[model samples]
Target chain A: MDLQKMMDLPGALAAFTYSDKGDLQSHVLREGTELTPQVLDLLAHSCVANQAIASMEARGWEALTGQSGFQPLKGFSMVGLEWSVVVDGNCGVVVKNRDADYEATFNALQAA
Target chain B: MHIVKQLMAIPGVVAAGEYAYRGDRFSYEGALTDEFARMASILCRANTLSVNMQSEIFDSFAENIGCRPVQGWIVRGSQITICAVGNYFAFIENRDELLNDVMTIMRAKVGDVQDDLLVNLYARLGGDTKEALY
Candidate 1:
């Protein structure tokens, strides 16, 4: 794999990371937002989804998702039924219902 | 480790692998843990929301073990910018958890507003090509 390509994968996916001081930093971005889901998806695709498998397999990271974006790329393990993104004030709660029957994950944000 | 397995059960929770803070890998499972008592304490704290189910648990494990836990997630959106800092890792485990985290962060900037279009815009911004944050 091309070194540039390897690096580009992370770039394409919009992957991000944060520090302990809440001073958020991202590889693909300058600041990291705790509430954004789209960015998270991109990061997963590059890291956990496609490149992650290759990276892990080269060194060997276990396969979480059997799907084929990358043969070894670890797909998300779906354990719950409903996944909700609930926002309250400036804070958001990403909660999941363990039961497979749950549906709605987003509940109306409480009035500030 | 039942905790590890429980997290793997969630949907969109990729890379449900196990790791040791002192050892070698850390697995992230999406969604917040159902441990009401612990969650309640976190809830009582100001600006506490379940960024992801496993995020809190991983933090707790870190606290107990005296090792920092590592998590990674991607944020994609139309208006959102992706800026280059370094290698960014997400604390929230899965897609659902990441969505919740995004809403929580947006609420602070916007307000108690829920606009599907706006939400979608923000989400799209996460995947900004140049990686600009604003």
Candidate 2:
């Protein structure tokens, strides 16, 4: 996906794509934003770590219930006072404003 | 113990537990096996640590643009929902439909008992029991 174009959505302050191992793959930041690559790497790893935990939880459930075909997680969202982060797999989008339309932003990200 | 029991009392709360940031379970109650519950608690602690780290990074840039600190995180999956309250963690299973309501109740219940919880945790760690009361 064209990550930069996807990041151009309204209220999107920054976006990053990482490998399954949490390595930084690509990123976009709004002009004048003070975020750094090191910080971005930390954020990416955090997202991947979250994904791993969710995956484990899913496996645990499958084991307990004898249920097969557990689907991997699509993504998760964290809302803060000033920003909201949505992470899907290795891709993460950080909205500038807490009130940003996360649903639309997520839809746009997926469609992109 | 009381907190776990209260959390378990809530509708759809399949499991409730308290764990240290280092992955030690203070208490837990649910249908999950002991090993599975411990793993979940530890994973939840890791998730919380990550959230806190992310928040700190954002805070460093808050001066450039006004931003408030992160309060907490809620990660909802198909079969479970994990919630972080303070340094403690809780997870619910097979209750995706009641996640929001359960979280709200759990948060409030946790708040009410956090002092006692901490005291007990302190004592469990072999800290001075008298100091824990304060």
Candidate 3:
């Protein structure tokens, strides 16, 4: 599915897709959103990196508890002063408002 | 340790800990076992790394336009919330919906101790420290 469809969600400022290797695959920013390409690239990479780290941490937890299998990390949401960024699988969406319902928006984006 | 205890006293905070930049748990309070504490530390450290990377990228881009880096960040999960405060990071595993309140209490208790924690972390790491803490 095209990640850009996330832009349809209210308050979504931008949507992006990236590989596990941090390579940007696609990106869409709302019109008049004054963000640079470098910033978008960085957000994408950070989202992917956050997922990688969370996965590692989850594995560590499973090892510590002797649980053979633990659910994989879905993504992470970082609440910044001005925006909230959420990443699921290989796709990320940035919402302009910090209080936006990122989890719901992310779910809708994935379900699209 | 005192700050950790205070954090644990907050409503909805199931576990609380103080961790170094490299995922070492210096002190913690709550129902977590030692192994779980270590895992929590690693998770919190990873959260901090993500925040730092994002800050760096935003700062670099902002610098070009006469702006500043982000001061801090909050990462919310299903049952956990991690907040980065300078060199040290603190997190609360909570089931209640008072994440902001928990973060506020954590920052109030541990915010000023960032330098002290960094020094202690440096001492524990045999003088090795991240340049950002300097």
Candidate topping lDDT: 2
TM-score of each: 0.19, 0.56, 0.64
Candidate 2 lDDT for residue B9: 79
Candidate 1 vs 3: which has more DockQ: 3
lDDT of 3 by residue, B64-117 (tens): 321122324455444555555443344555344455465455445544333243
- Worst 10 contiguous positions by lDDT, candidate 1 chain B: B79-88
Residue A28, model 2, lDDT? 86
In order, the candidates keep a fraction of the true contacts of 0.00, 0.28, 0.22
Better of 1 and 2 by TM-score: 2
Docking class of 1: incorrect
Over the stretch A1-112, how does candidate 1's per-residue lDDT look in tens digits? 1212212221121223333322224433213323244433322332232222223432321133222232222222111112222221222223332211111211121211
lDDT of 2 by residue, B1-134 (tens): 46677777777676677676356655678776777667766666666556655666656754433323443466655555566664455566544345545545554555522323334334545657675455
lDDT of 2 by residue, A1-112 (tens): 6778767766787888888888888888878766666666767877787767667766776776564433455456665545666787668887764335544555565566
Which segments of model 3 are wrong by more than 4 Å? Answer: A2-5, A8-10, A67-70, A109-112, B1-13, B20-25, B61-134
Error of 2 at B26 (Å): 2.0
Error of 2 at B85 (Å): 2.2
In terms of TM-score, which candidate is strongest? Answer: 3
